[model samples]
Target: MAIARTWKSHSVLPGFGLALGFTILYLSLIVLIPLSATFIKSAELSLGEFWAVVTAPRALASYRLSFGAAAIGALLNAGFGLLTAWILVRYTFPGKRLVDAFVDLPFALPTAVAGIALTAVYAPNGWLGQWLEPLGIKVAFTPLGVVVALTFIGLPFVVRTVQPVLEDLEAEIEEAAACLGANRWQTFARVLLPALWPALITGFALAFARAVGEYGSVVFIAGNMPMISEISPLLIITKLEQHEYAGATAIAVVMLVASFALLLVINSLQWWVSHRHGRKQ
Candidate 1:
């Protein structure tokens, strides 16, 4: 009787074991195993060696540049993405569909091609860069160029993530607020912004993550200047090129941990926002 009951209960959760098995195997193969291998390799380095690998003045500078540009780019994307989504959702104009399609260009275009195009356009000898050169605003092979590349890649993440949420939002709520004597700014601030906050955070996090690991598009325009415009991913590849596997893995592990921590912080913020939103509801 007991065995039969157990079998029946298992039938109720028939796929439970299969699901768990699949999840564990998938995670191990894809994430945990690869990361564990990195740790194993990194562990071969002494503490001093690990520190030296990660904290070389050049490496540290690259870390700062990579993370800083990604943060700034994410922030810029959040603001501009919101504006872009609002425009796409709320307005209809000539070339609207074309403009919409263009938003995905970053996603479709090869990163190397994008890099070359961006460098050409921003180099002092190139079209727009020619005009800006007199102003001494050097865009190519500089930190500004890194930010530009990160921004270019991250923009789509934000815009696309936020678009559907914006589309699904009810205009009636904003209209009610306006009809009840609230001004445009007030309606947006007090009524509309809260609902969009979660999506914005999600989009920002997605962009930030994507930008942090970006390499190809950044390399050409960054000029690979150590302690200047070089990014962390480039540094990792540099280590690999020199056959310093331990050093490469150490840096990779650092990046992995930092990225995980960042997403954790963002998740906590998401939870808080969601909790407050639920309370308001």
Candidate 2:
């Protein structure tokens, strides 16, 4: 008799092909089409013109401020967010629920409103700014202001991402490490951190992406001064206002490509870390 072959597959949901087809179609309509249009519009410019537009002094300055501020802000958020999440997960106190709810304020508040409030609090002669001015430190209308705004908006991302991971982490692991004669720092560094690393990276990438394209919040405090505190999104708007559509699209394309590349790298790192950790188990 001839040999026979058999295959079996299982899924809770039915019509897997149909569901996947719908997902791809929806994504293409919403995301792929718009992005393709942006690229096509930018393609109207010649190579030399595209290069000039992206490499202009103002454009270069905006890129530096935008990426630099975002990187600094994301890094700050990672550290502080981890601490915040740790406290929320490991300890309980009065008004704990209120404090947890407050973490999502940035997600709920309008960006314009947040910008106005930040400017009011940080501008020279404004509450905190008044005290800092005499110390020769400035916040509003400076690159530092941009970083502050980015940090404020991006903090929630890291917190939310890492919070769940921390909650799922059992306290017994720490106890076990201590039982093995590990100090507090050693327990954290050797046990907790490995499990949290992937989530932390994901949060950092999310924060960085959010900060890069932020416009409304950053514009108010940035003073819109070209080559000083202006950001890339603001620069794109400036180009658009001048009817330089091609130039605007060119800049947008650069931002899109750079952000995508950075996120891709971060995601790959997250996957690799998760895979290695899994193998160790």
Candidate 3:
């Protein structure tokens, strides 16, 4: 006798259709509609106007500063984050728990508060800044300050992303590599890196994305100087304050498109790495 196919066998969750509908509805209301409105508002400008708005000297400068600083900050976080995860996972020490807890401080701290604190610490008359200024280094109210703020907030993304993966990884793999005559660098590059590469990419992408859209912490440290330290998000706010809604939307659209494109590239890289690794297995 023939048996009937059941929905329960295909899906663990009951009401799959209902769940799918709700998912789409929720996304439409929360994400799609708002994004659609941004596109529509930006369309108010002529194509030439849109191009001019997004490509103005000030806009280009802001784009460079924003994307460049974010990329630098994310890259910094990736290396240090990997090191931190390795230490946290592979070693036991006093204050380990406290250090782990401190990693989440940026998430819990208010963005404005974090900005103020960083500013105070890095300001000319402030603690670290007072020492650094005499040596010709400036942190507060500069492009470097933007980078510092981005790095501060973005660190947690990288650390948290790699931590769980590091925890699940077995130390025996390293021991086996060493037994096979691999040195420390060789073991890490040949053995550990392959396992950690995907997680590292994910963390980098998260940090980059977070830093790209960041406003609060960057604004205070960036000095709000047009074409100098101003970020794209801050530029958008400036346009809005001037009641140039179309201009603001135009900048927003550029940021959204660029962010989406970069993220897509990162995710594609991740998928390719995973696929290549799976084939090796």
**Cα-based lDDT for every prediction:** 0.90, 0.93, 0.93
- What does the lDDT read for residue 125 in candidate 1? 96
lDDT of 3 at 250: 100
Q: Give me the candidate number with maximum TM-score.
A: 2
Residue pair clashes in candidate 2: none
Consecutive 10-residue window with the lowest summed lDDT within model 2: 1-10
Question: For residues 1-281, what per-residue lDDT tens digits would candidate 1 score against the true structure?
Answer: 12454643555656888888999999999989988999999999999999988888988898899899999999999999899999999899999999899889999988888889999999999998999999989999999999999999988888898899889888898899999999999999988888888889999999999999999899989898888888999999998999999999999989999999999999789778966763465
Model 3 alpha-carbon miss at residue 61, Å: 0.4
Candidate 1 accuracy as TM-score: 0.92
Task: Please provide, for model 3 over 73-157, each residue's C-alpha lDDT reduced to its tens digit, 9 standing for 90 to 100.
Answer: 9999999999988888999999999999998998889998999999999999999999999999999999999999999999999
Give the clash count for each candidate: 0, 0, 0
Q: Which stretches of candidate 3 lie over 4 Å from their true place?
A: 1-19
Candidate 1 weakest lDDT stretch, 10 residues = 1-10
Clashing pairs in 3: none
